[model samples]
Target: MASRKPSTDDTTHKLKEDLHHLTQTIEDLVSATADDSRSNIKELRARAEKRLKETRDRLESRGERLYDEARDSVTHQVDACDRYVHDNPWTSVGLGAAAGIVIGMLIGRR
Candidate 1:
């Protein structure tokens, strides 16, 4: 037995085909509703709902993955800042406030 792999060009062409089909389907569904055809309206609504669910699931998973990737770096930076501030509160406060002011001014110029 042999397994088949999908290529990038094939995937691109398939995406274009899918977009055309979905557009035509939605148009047909809308026209059906305008003409008071309940069956098509129901079918299209179901398809749209399913697509939204899938899209949301994908986004949530990707967002979780992104957060996981940055979590360690963000935590380490925060911890380092905490140690610095604890060691020299006055100096850390002055430096942080100065940095914030400088950043604010730069952003304001932009």
Candidate 2:
């Protein structure tokens, strides 16, 4: 079975969603501060900072996870190809030659 790569579009969409939610949270926090006393304002500020920190941490963790997943996927593909070539060296060689010739001809036609 072949491993499927993650979609960049999905990742981008998720990031946009996260940002949108964060923006909404900030806007709400700002508007909610209008009727608050000094102590309440300080409390809201602390909560806002905490929320921002949590969002940052979540985004960083997600980005790291995606990077690791992509790296592992590529490594797995290369390992599979290496095993296939080892098991069928002659076939691999012929395929490589054919690919090279095709590429050369394509380049020549340019």
Per-candidate TM equals: 0.44, 0.71
In model 1, how large is the Cα lDDT of residue 36? Answer: 74
**lDDT (Cα, 0-100) at 57 in candidate 1:** 67
Steric clashes per prediction = 0, 0
Highest-scoring model, lDDT: 2
Candidate 1 stretches with Cα past 4 Å from truth are 1-31, 76-110
Q: How accurate is candidate 2 locally (lDDT)?
A: 0.84
- Candidate 2 on 1-110: residue-level lDDT in tens? 99875588977887787777778777767877887577767776777777778779878988898889889999999999999999999999999999999999999999
RMSD of candidate 1 to the truth, in angstroms, is: 8.4
Task: Give the per-residue lDDT of model 1 (tens digit) for 18-37.
Answer: 56666766676677778777
Q: Candidate 1 at residue 60, lDDT?
A: 72
Please give the CA lDDT of all the candidate structures: 0.74, 0.84
